[model samples]
Structure formats: structure tokens, C-alpha cells
Target: MEKMPAKQYEMGSSTSTKSMQPQKFLHSKRIGHMDSFSRHEMMYDPPSMESKSMPRSSYFNSSKPWPDLESDESDMENEIDIDNLPPIEVGPHEHRLQYTYWLWFSRKGTHRATDYSKSLRVVGRCASVQQWWSLYSHLKRPTALHPYRDLSLFKQGIKPMWEDPANSKGGQWVIRLRKNQIDRAWENVCMAMLGEQFLVGDEICGVVLTTRSPECSLSVWNRTATDHASTTRIRDTLRRILNIPVSVPMEYKIHCDSLKYVAISKGPLKS
Candidate 1:
């Protein structure tokens, strides 16, 4: 499929055009991790004292524990059942997006440092506009999610974590929004990212919507915090896309600073 020119996404232009035909791109069926409910059921047993004493680094190990491995495989088996769900019909001509994106969900764990990665799960993936809508339509609105829950839409292959290789040297533009503003703001940012409206090329990593008590926040992750020009463009483009007023504060926090904070909070490393 021919890529749509970046010019097509310039400010003030409509995101979609009549000339763009939906190209047939294969949708990846491997949605990572199970839904929160199923995962919670599988992990009902309390953490053992031995497990708690294990080095914190072990929790982030690339290898999965036996029970988690079993649940992961079972979740893969259920992907076949997706076709049975209520159909979200798209015409033969679907609008192919510039890049495939994955949706991820996470809930804060009892331990802030470790629970995050353990709770992270891939909700679904989409390569075209129709598929994105199909996945999104089935999800509860941001307003419905409980506090401490996060919904992120990231480019495929990039995990929404500070330690991920793509994100390790980067930072994010964070914008806090009122409870009532989340739904519209989240949709607008996702559409902007998928449409390549940021114009930062591959520098743009993903967008996240985090729900919290009384307020919610959205963050746009990028590949480099040192590239002032690109980062500035992203911040400006984000403001334009979200139509956020100047009064609403936007905070930029580097991943390294965040890592330092985590390390300090966790205290000295155990031998």
C-alpha cells in the first residue's frame, strides 16, 4: 500500500480523504496478556513469603512463571473466538493507517514498583482505521475505568514502559485533564497519533490515558528528550490537536529522572 504523504496530515486539514483507499493489511491476532478479570482469577492465591523475599529484579525477568505462562497460552487460544463477537462491519474499502498500533491496559498493583509491569496487558491491535474502531468500540470509555487504571495506544513492538529500549532515552509530554474531558481528549490524541499529525516521524512512540481520582491525564511519549526541536514540535502539535488551552499546564519528565525517583523510593538495592 502506498503511504499517505505527511503533508496530508497538516493542521486544519481533515484527517481522512476520499482518495485514500483502505489497503488490505493483515491484522495480528496475537493480543498479549489476558483481560484483568481472567488474570485476577488465575492469580487468586496470595503471594507467598518466599516469593516476597525474592529479589525485586526477578519480578521483571523476561521468563514468565509457570502459572502465568499457562494463562498466556490460554489467552492466545481465545483469540479465535473474536470472530463470534458482534460484527463491526467495514466496507471493502477500509482506510489503512500509516502504522499498526497496539492497545494496552494496566492497573496499579499493591506494590507500585513491581505491579505495573505485571499488570500490563495488550488489549488488541489494529492496522487500519476500521480495525481500530472495532477494537475501541468494544472498550469501556476512559470515564468508566477505575482510578489507577491506564489505557495506552502505542505503535506495535513498543511496550509502554520507561525501560523499553525505544523509550529509555526519551520522555513524555503530560497533560492533566478534568474527569469530564477524558473521553474526547483521549480520542483526539489517538486519532492525531494514528494520522501522523505530530509530524515528528518515528520519534513519536505512543499516547497514554491514565485515570485517577478527581482527574485524568494524557501523555505522549517520544524517542528523545535531548532533541529539543522535535520535542518542542511534539508539545506544540499536541496542544493544537487536543485544543488544550495555555492555562492547562503541560509537564515534561525524562525517563532517567523517573528511574531515579523509583530507585530512591525503593531504597538501596538488596544484594
Candidate 2:
């Protein structure tokens, strides 16, 4: 895979100096059912579609840290050959994760404004630490993606969409951060989830990182929206894992609520 040039940023002196230590959360425990070796296929040939580039608006100026839509396409093209890559090797001594996870990618579609799910594709799947790192190291960081692009890490059988059976009754904890702060935050939270640091078994369906101008957001999706105890535990774990201050707000929106909002926003379907 071709490595795209990393975009440099001019950080202002006013940016937060708080350094995050993500290494401390590396502790892992075998928490769920194990998977067979044959289940470790890590790539697929995603259906191709014409790239629809959105015009750069005034909101996306030169000062923004992320690349524009044009540059994002190059990153996408680099990833298109993932399916042709050789399978990742997993040694007998390698540490296996609790559950198999898949890395999915999607960009907002111009024609189907509300149905971005149509663009969702599985880019990688991993059953162990080595497999995960091999795939992750090849992808661009959140800062390199375009505003509407999203990267999701979900359990093997679960889809990242709200409508998925595993996700239909759940919600996500959303946290928005400045562009400079997202890379580490995203890496930490993902590690926390994969390590089962949250301690809520099977509740975590997936985690998503969405890139936008000015700020990027990370959300943790769980299986039960009504389980206050589990939800609260997930939130507290997120704060600790990300080293976020209590003053920073974290919002939890249930999938039902999100579905309703989308339905309302789209209005009634015409005959």
C-alpha cells in the first residue's frame, strides 16, 4: 500500500498541553468465547462506486487540519487493494482477543444523503493483536480522513449501523475533540474496548471515529440503552481511558431516538 504524505499542522501555543499516556491501559484479559483459526479472514473486495466529491465550502478553509475531499480519495484508493493483500500471520503464541473485530469504512454519499449505510464496507478483520496492528498500521489516522468519512471497529457479527439487531436497542456515548487531540484519543479508546477494560461483557457492539471540520468525534456503542448501570460504567471507563476531564461533556443518544430524529428530518415518504 502507498503511504500518503502526512499533512503537517501549525499548532497554536494555546492548544492544550495535557499529555495522554495510553500505554498504561495495555493490560488484556481473555473475556469471551474463543474463535477458530479459520475465522481470521481480514479483507474483502468491497463493491466499487463512482467517487462523488463534495465541493469545498467556506467552512473548510486552509487553516483546517484535515485534508479536503480530493486528498481523501487518494487515501481511499490506497485502501482499495486491501482484499488482494496476503493474510496476516497469527503465531501459536500470539495473544487472542476476546472477540473477533472488523474494521469498517464509509463516506457520506451525495445521492443518498440520509442513507450513508450504502457506502459502508469492511476493510479488515482481526482475531488477535498481531492481526489488528497489521491492518491498523496501514490506514490513515482520523485527521487524514475527509469531514464526512467514518472509521468503525465492530464485533465480527455486528454491523455498525443503528438498525442492526445487536445495536437496535442500544446507544452510543459521544465525545467530540479538537483535531490535534483525536488521534491519541481514538487509539486509546479502541485499545480499551479491545482489552475489555470497560468490564461490560458483550455490551460493547463497536466504536466509531468520525472526522469533521474544526472537531472530530469518537463514540462507543453498547447493546442496551436502558441498562443504566452498564451505561454508566461504560461512560466512567471511557473518561478514565481517554483521560478526559469531568468538565468535558459526553452525550449518550439511544438508537431509537436517533432513528426517530432521522425519520423526522427526512419527513414522510412520498407515494
For model 2, residues 186-209, the per-residue Cα lDDT tens digits are 776786777777888999999999
Off by over 4 Å in 1: 1-92, 110-112, 269-271
Worst 10 residues of 1 by lDDT: 23-32
lDDT of each: 0.62, 0.65
lDDT of 1 by residue, 1-271 (tens): 0111212121223222221111211111111121111222222222321222232112122233212212435334323222232323334666556677877777665336544666676556676665565555556778878888788999877989998999999999887777766776776678668767777889999999988888778899999989888898888877676655454556787998898787787787667
Candidate topping TM-score? 2
Model 2 scores a C-alpha lDDT of 0.65
In candidate 2, which residue ranges exceed 4 Å CA deviation? 1-90, 269-271
Q: Model 1 residue 256 lDDT?
A: 85
Question: Each model's TM-score?
Answer: 0.65, 0.68
* Span of ten consecutive residues with least summed lDDT in model 2: 28-37
